[model samples]
Target chain A: MQKKSRGGIFVISAPSGAGKTTICKKILSRNANIKQSVSFTTRKPRKGEKNGEDYYFVAQKTFQQMISRNEFIEWAEVHGNFYGTSRKKFEGLVSSGFDVILDIDTQGARQIRNSFSEGVFIFILPPSIKVLRERLQDRKSNTKKDMQRRLKRAAVEIKDYNMYDYVIVNDILGDSVKKLEAIITARRMSSDRVDPKWIKDNFLR
Target chain B: MQKKSRGGIFVISAPSGAGKTTICKKILSRNANIKQSVSFTTRKPRKGEKNGEDYYFVAQKTFQQMISRNEFIEWAEVHGNFYGTSRKKFEGLVSSGFDVILDIDTQGARQIRNSFSEGVFIFILPPSIKVLRERLQDRKSNTKKDMQRRLKRAAVEIKDYNMYDYVIVNDILGDSVKKLEAIITARRMSSDRVDPKWIKDNFLR
Candidate 1:
């Protein structure tokens, strides 16, 4: 009998402005197996941001109500804003045989891992802390103080690299994408996912 | 720190005349990541068989001595002829980060899996039992009874296809090679081999 397709959740965590969003966009556009998870955030929508597409923007009271109802797979507050993933949405995507990709903070990532022990956790890294500082400064969006704060926080974050399933350095965009794609492709054919019946029926006795 | 390269072993098993060896040859020539694991056998060298390159030919007494010493990874007798894999050679290739491909029988494949639980196993099947019988009959190298015996043996072997990581139906040679390549390529990126350190240091805080 043919086995049914099984889907997994791919949790990709990266420091701010490390190109995780862009890479995820490219992969989702190319890969048929992946579905990106849109998060719900209790923050005012910025100009050009579409609700339910960019994020499910809600008021603080509304987000707290959802939290009280335990509707989220995982949630956390950052910079006075609440961000969370809906458990129902995540389950719907996986049950349909599409691996869901979650772009979230490390705390959220860990929570998801605790809930789904087999979730594929991938961490993205900059080539170096110095390069990261330069990239953040180059963006012209953050103040010098803001850049310094991020770099300092990044040092602490880098220590958790060992907790992930795959670590990719953003030394080059194209190469990093190749490495990520390779990881996803290989994980799909893992021994746990293989059907032993296929082997027993084909190999000579 | 620089991450280690990820590699994997792919064991391909098929009955005689199923074209596994030919497909393996094409696959190795195409994939730079794969290297063939040449087996050691005590069978008398048929005409045109080259020593070391084809099979490591050894005397029956020497083969038995090696078996007693536990020098071979797996050994089995077929038609009073002995075949086995050299453990040292296989280990050396694997430690060097080259994915080794084993073209062997089901028994040998099972032994390899037991010894190397991490290896990816694939089984190849003919399109139908009728096609398998016709292919064996056309070989002309075996007697009619021998051909019938092999055909009967193949049917029993087909029952074990469920034991493999992947199965290829060898109706077309080109498509079969592509399928094998995809499986191997995917196997190399599994989380067990690929390092995740870079991801933690760069991405999550």
Candidate 2:
């Protein structure tokens, strides 16, 4: 019998209002073998957010201690709130042969790239800047000034699309989800991931 | 509008009895934009083979003259017959933005790899050597000696699977076809293949 191979890490990054969350959710719903990586955050959970399921809500002091001990594979502070992915958890899941999907910003993705070279990096883009502006405007959760700031941040983030292995223009939700799923399926069949011993045992003899 | 990008070359190589020819035919029938690259050969046409559709049949003298003129991308002498692919035709199809699939042996695939660095190489393997032997036995076209020779050749070719970008074990035809299709779809979304000008015009600006 062939030994099960280690799982793959798929990191997805997108600018605000690119519909990445929706695409990720759709992919997770369709694939039973893939699991989402829940991040550890110092920020308090909003209403209906479950611990360990949504985010592992940790005290600021505990987050700082974890950072000092070098427990994070990638971590960053946004709006003075600490957020990080645990190295132990990620490695454990991968070693157990469970593919993990991480939905993070470019900053966190960069850190992950530095620490783990095998991760597949994917970037999502809105169909156009005009579409992005309209989507942000429709949210109503942000003030005009905040919306403008988000648009500026998106412009900067979209420039980093070149760093990713795959790019998905989120013009339609279903199409983008299919593309994302294809990437995962194709990556699994990569020759580098196949076990040479298994090939030798089955085909050579 | 985005200028049409140059097309991609997909090369599939497999040992005998791996079902690669069937898979390639299915893929070509399903995809409207993909074309098969016909080879030029000095061998006589079989009962149902056509001149241009199956192969560009040529005299030994003409094949030698074309080789002297550097017209072929890759050529080889097999069983005292010359077979080659036209460099002009391959480049023309690619430059016209039509994806081309080349169903060739490992020798031709290696030659193409030396000439073109961008081609996607896929290696197909039968489920096991026992299965391969059974399938070759079922053909009954080959004598016992010829079948033995083919089995030996298959052993040598299967070792080259590591040189390919993707490896598909041909245990199930439908599953292997889906994996091959996924590879093509995912490659289209590769960030490196995306036009920078298009991104700048549509999303960045």
The pairs that clash in candidate 2 are none
In angstroms, how far off is B50's CA in candidate 2? 2.6
Cα deviation of B67, candidate 1, in Å: 2.0
Alpha carbon deviation, residue B13, candidate 1 (Å): 3.6
- Writing each residue's lDDT as its tens digit, candidate 2 over B146-198 gives 89888988988899998899888889999988989888888788888878888
Q: Which candidate ranks first by lDDT, i.e. highest? A: 2
DockQ of 2: 0.84
Model 1 regions lying over 4 Å from their true place: A43-49, A191-205, B1-8, B14-19, B44-49, B78-80, B114-205
Error of 1 at A175 (Å): 3.1
Q: Candidate 2, residue A161: CA error in Å?
A: 0.9
Model 1 RMSD, rounded to 1 decimal: 4.2
DockQ of each: 0.23, 0.84
lDDT of 1 by residue, A1-205 (tens): 2344658778988777677887888888888878988999988897778999889998888899999999999998765689999988888888888888999878798898899986888888777766787788887758888876777667666666656776666788887777777667555544456455654554444
**Which ranges of candidate 2 are over 4 A from the true structure?**
A1-3, B1-3
